[model samples]
Target: MPFRRKLLEQTQRDIKRLKNKGHKPTTLLGIFLYGGTLGFLFVVPIVGGAYLGLWLDELIAGYSEHWTLNLILLGIAVGGYNVFRFLRDKT
Candidate 1:
């Protein structure tokens, strides 16, 4: 009886937590959309940084990839931050 009561209390607490957070059941389409959004958020900055760095390197007239690498790293940092912010906001 004590075990059953504890289990029921735990379940009730979980349900309350979900309800308080406005948790929604995920669907296939929703899954796809969320994944796509995450991908876009993560990739766009990298691609943009690559292009901009390439352009700058070309303008510099040198055989170095310093700018491209630096920008790509920066892009990755930005993308990570974006994903972190998105997840934090969702939760």
Candidate 2:
């Protein structure tokens, strides 16, 4: 009986704490906007890297995709890092 009473009191306190925290509810529009921003952040770096790689390849008279491939890979790494940082900070 004593243990059950203590448990009930603890549960009430937890409920009170949660109610006081005042967390805002998430909306559908907020979710969509966040998704769109995340996508844009991810894509911009990759495309920029591809474009830069292509330009570098064109500058040199070589029939090789070395620059393009390297830059694209670099871009992927950068974009992944950006997304990771954004999410970490957001949370």
Candidate 3:
């Protein structure tokens, strides 16, 4: 029937429009994955390094002022290194 043929034609046109629009579901998923990966790569190590230094300082020096200052310096160093690497990385 003509109605069936028109429905098929409309469906084909919709598929072409969708393809041309470049709005696939995978595009959003890829964006999210890339964002999450970059966040994890950049953030997790800095936080983990600070926490590790804090734990080590507490275990070794108890409640001393030197321990507190040294741990803070260690965290600063780690943060500085992270910033430096980020600035240096081109890829």
Candidate 4:
């Protein structure tokens, strides 16, 4: 169909444009390294938040898990934002 041909042509053009924009094909090792880095970025904040919360809880005494839970949630939010920003910037 004419429509299908047009779509294919557009897709090819887009691919060409992307290629011209310095988008090199990535290797498997690069992908794995990116994945590992992303995972570390997402996890470090969470662990740090948990540790800080635990320390705060120890210092405070009465609330117990209140600080820990709140900080963990905050960490997750921050980590998600961080990952989003990283991906956005890289892309």
Candidate 5:
């Protein structure tokens, strides 16, 4: 059909135009901000875990640091996983 042919021609032209265009990040500030955000995302959980773990350990009123240590390790693992997932999706 003539209509189909015209539609196909238009799509072809659009594709060619798109092929000439480049999408990239060219801003230093943007790069730093994104990096900071990624770092923040990765650090918050660890700090939060540390705080919570410390509180939990204090509740038992003892000289043991099992909860604090375990939670801190858990936090590190969670932060690493979060950063990994974020980078995977973003980049």
Candidate 6:
């Protein structure tokens, strides 16, 4: 069998196992919390960073150039590090 096929088979098996385990309320809640946190972890930083950059630009009002870009890059670096850490833990 191909690698993809094996991966799919394993995934189905895991799903079946979870279902067979009775899908307790706590288990479902845990899954939802994990998924929600993952989503927020990925999205919040970019949106918050953009807002912060815009606010900073307004406050400084041309005292220095490229400040917004610098803040955006910092946000990207932080978000990228988080994603890297998540993937590292999975592997």
Q: Which stretches of candidate 2 lie over 4 Å from their true place?
A: 1-22
TM-score versus the correct structure, for each prediction: 0.73, 0.72, 0.42, 0.71, 0.75, 0.49
Best by lDDT: 4
Q: Write the per-residue lDDT of candidate 5 for residues 6-81, one digit (tens) a residue.
A: 9999999999878865565469998899899899988998999989989999889668788889998999999999
Candidate 6 accuracy as lDDT: 0.76
Q: What is the lDDT of residue 2 in candidate 2?
A: 100
Model 2's alpha-carbon lDDT is 0.89
- Give one digit per residue, the lDDT tens place, for model 3 in 1-91: 9999999999999999988867655678877976665566556656666576667677874564554556566656666676566556834
Write down the lDDT that model 5 would get: 0.89
Please tell me which predicted candidate would have the highest TM-score against the true structure. 5
Candidate 5 Cα RMSD (Å)? 2.7
Residue-pair clashes per prediction, in order, are 0, 0, 0, 0, 0, 0
Ranking by TM-score: 5, 1, 2, 4, 6, 3
* Residue 53 C-alpha lDDT in model 3: 63
Candidates 3 and 4, the one with greater lDDT: 4
Question: Model 2, range 56-81, lDDT digits (tens) per residue?
Answer: 99998868688889988998888889
Q: Which regions of candidate 5 fall more than 4 Å away from where they truly are?
A: 1-25
Stretches off by above 4 angstroms in model 4 are 1-23
Model 4 accuracy (lDDT, Cα): 0.91
Better model by lDDT: candidate 4 vs candidate 6: 4
**What's the C-alpha lDDT at position 18 in model 2?**
92
Model 3, position 27, has a per-residue lDDT of 75
Q: Score candidate 5 by TM-score against the native.
A: 0.75
**Candidate 3 residue spans exceeding 4 A from truth:** 1-26, 62-91
